[model samples]
Target: MTTITAGRLREAAELLGIRNQATLNEIRARYSERVKEWHPDVSQNDPAESHEMTIRLKEAYDLLTDYCMNRPVSFRLEDLEKDLEQSPADYWMERFGDDPIWG
Candidate 1:
């Protein structure tokens, strides 16, 4: 029973394109495909890039699978979408206050 944080879960989902209430099967399938695509044996034998991709792929898969198995079906996607929408505006404002982009 590994303890997982919301941020980690979100990061994994983003990495694996698991947005908008995607299913566990989708997560596993996508992650498996990505791993295959980025696997060291298949990535032109570039050890450095392969290692990095492998690490990222493993992290994303582990987090997503953990979340998928543990989280309830009642989990809501609307809250995450709203948060993403607001985060960008808040970030832009902080970077450049009263910008025309807000209009």
Candidate 2:
């Protein structure tokens, strides 16, 4: 039940050089490229800097993946308010459909 703000999502997207609309595949590809570029053993830069960059890239990738997986289809204020009015089960059912195992 952690709340994810739009600002956080935008920051993660920017760090990974991706648009807000990027798909999971796009995120994974970009993350792979960045990891290769910043991997301490591969980059031949100051190991500390390379390690830091790789850590940052992994963090951004995790954040974006979590956001994308849990995000609602849209974020209109009115829609959120309406969703809040529903019971948790109803809200999840509406958002994710009737996947029995997940719901």
Candidate 3:
């Protein structure tokens, strides 16, 4: 798997309407709220933002998943797969079982 750059992750957050670094719970809560608000069904009045929000949501999720999986020092390979299955976009199994130090 490729290394995840902080710049790319930050960019994803910005696209997802996230203005600051956040915990996993914070990311999930905020992402859900934004998705609900911008869902095409909910935001019929603004199709443009809705479409953009969809793409942004995916990016944000991927970045958050990658970041999270790459953190824990004792991360496990099976856990990575579980994470991916539970939240594929944010799972990032590849990064977890790689080098001892991602840096």
User: Per-residue lDDT tens digits of candidate 1, residues 53-90?
Assistant: 88998888887777678666543698667656767667
Q: Estimated TM-score per prediction?
A: 0.59, 0.63, 0.56
Estimate, for each residue in 1-103, the C-alpha lDDT of model 2 and write its tens digit. 5467888778878888886467899999999988999999999899999999899899889989998797678679998888578897776577667677775
lDDT (CA) per prediction: 0.77, 0.84, 0.73
Candidate order by decreasing TM-score: 2, 1, 3
Alpha carbon lDDT of residue 33, candidate 2? 88
Which lDDT tens digits does candidate 3 get at residues 31-100?
Answer: 8887887788878657887887777787678778778876866459988666557564333455454557
lDDT of residue 17 for candidate 1: 68
Candidate 1 local lDDT, residue 89: 61
In model 3, the runs with Cα more than 4 Å from the true position are: 1-3, 74-103
Off by over 4 Å in 2: 1-3, 73-103
Name the lDDT value of residue 28 in candidate 1.
82
